[model samples]
Target: MSIAASSDAARATRRPVNANGVPIHTTSFIGTNWTNRTAESPPPPEPGSYYPMAFLVEQPPGSVVQSHFHAADQFQVVVAGGGHLGRHAVRPVTVHYTNAHTAYGPITAGEAGLHYFTLRNGYDPGARYVPQEAAALKAVPGRTPWQTTTAPVEPGPVIEGPARMEEMLEPRADGLGAWRHILPPHAALTGPDPAQGMGQFWVVTGGRLDGMPPLSLIFVNPQDAARTAMAGAEGAECLILQYPRRAADA
Candidate 1:
């Protein structure tokens, strides 16, 4: 398991890119530097093993991210501002999941701009854009173009009570699931077993978790024992994101 506070994350912007003649506008808050994009010469991706990646992308208002797909499954949580992720309007607390190689998006930031965190359990070279990379996409073995969006919820102040749990994405046979938990001040709550899925990411969307403020993140591996989340004085509201069963396990 790994725990990190967003405030301590490394921040950077890619060298100006305008291959398509459209400026790529983004600032990254990197929580794990498995492959440092900010390095003068970023290292090549390691092969044969998993390296988790978690980072936040901040887009200025009106900026657009072209439709693309990645080589690994990922969960993107919109943490603030508003946008249309493809055709779906996305706002804070909205969860979006896409299976590996499943193309999606053309994310357009709203007037307030958009902020989202990208969480993945394995390494991916980078985004493969549509139309331009359309042939490359067709060359790869197809996985189901599986994707889903959860309704957005406004984070509220914590209440006094035993922690409350809500299923934002219904658990499926393949073990993909998403949950939101609200913990009262200083209360401790054991999360769902990580062994039940490929991996899990606990995100502090509101209040605090073990003294870490909002945007704090925890990544739990499948072999890790179920971990407990203890709320800080202001309480905590967290979103749990789990990946589906890996092919080997299935």
Candidate 2:
């Protein structure tokens, strides 16, 4: 489904819980694939099927997520607070990508805590912690296990500049890419065709999207037409994330 989710509207779905004695809040934005999901509960999707998942996670100060990897490719965008993903420090608007089976992170929240949105084009049962599940980890023939990080974008004029797009993760032949757009009030920007990638997620990081406030999320399916983001009166800043072609697509 090609639809938009307003940040305010998603607030109703917020569920607070404790993970290993740490307080955390998970808010669903695009799909219900996350609710009550566990490592063995949600059955895997049919081969070659497409599933999109998007949500925001808030971790209290000093919270930590042990090093792990998922069975599906995903992107983690740090939208607020401060933290360290392994050795690299992260703050607002930092984008991190990891192909399936690529292990990374022991994410530790700083004094301010950590808030990030996780986006995925495929369903992953849950994280597989290292060493323990290490025996289950096997490399896929053609799926390159890779990782990338984009520099953070500060507030204000940094996002109020002339309407233009900045490459975050350079576009690849496999359709893996990311871009940030800075648009003046009411300005319009069309995204890359979804046919070229697994799917696309339009995230409003600054200002508004069709009048929706920041944190708004729009998911465009591969079969749908390219989405055009219309800035709200206050202007806008957005992140366009495209998933790479999966083996099933071949």
TM-score of 2: 0.90
Q: Pick the candidate with the highest lDDT.
A: 2
Candidate 1: pairs in clash: none
Q: Encode model 1's per-residue lDDT on 133-241: one tens digit a residue.
A: 9888778764667899888988877699678889999998788999999988898978888889888888889888877778878888888899886888988999999
Residue 136 in candidate 2, Cα distance off native in Å:
0.9
Report the lDDT tens digits of candidate 2 across residue range 119-171: 88877656678777676675444546688877777755634557978898999
Q: Could you tally the backbone clashes for each prediction?
A: 0, 0
lDDT of each: 0.78, 0.83
Residue 132 of model 1 has an lDDT of 88
| Model 2 worst lDDT run, 10 consecutive residues | 41-50
